[model samples]
Target: MSENNKFKDFFKFGDFGNYFVRVFQKPDPNQKSNYNLRMMHGINKISIVVFLLAIIFWIVKRFI
Candidate 1:
């Protein structure tokens, strides 16, 4: 196999190697106290809320 094929095979599993996969991964308890992790969690929560609000707005706008 070529170098490209080897790299492809490493992540061939569906969604297994996707960029967002890591975002859904469980946080390590050991790192829970880290400031960076706390900040990341806050960001993730805000982003999710914003995304949901955007979807709701789009639906309402579409119907009305």
Candidate 2:
């Protein structure tokens, strides 16, 4: 099999993009509200932010 066909099995970019938007955007109005799910998303957003910040700090510390 070609490399393109092999990579196709890894992930679809559209699904990844949709997940990022779903995590950050307001929940749909028609959907039922769930406090636990909301809190989980909130925690996820915080962790992603922290991870990115740590990466940036590490890069800067390495260069300077």
TM-score of each model, in listed order: 0.51, 0.70
Cα lDDT tens digits, model 1, 1-64, are: 8999999988687764453556666766776367887788678767877998999999999999
* Local error of candidate 2 at residue 61 (angstroms): 0.7
Taking all chains together, the TM-score of candidate 1 against the true structure is 0.51
Candidate 1: how large is its RMSD? 7.2
Clashing pairs in 1: none
Cα lDDT, model 1, residue 2: 100
For candidate 2, lDDT tens digit of each residue in 1-64? Answer: 8899879866667887688768989888999989999999999999988998999999999999
Top candidate on TM-score is 2
User: What C-alpha lDDT values do all the predictions have?
Assistant: 0.76, 0.88
Q: Give the C-alpha lDDT of model 2.
A: 0.88
Quality of model 1 by C-alpha lDDT:
0.76
As a whole number from 0 to 100, the lDDT of residue 37 in candidate 1 is 75
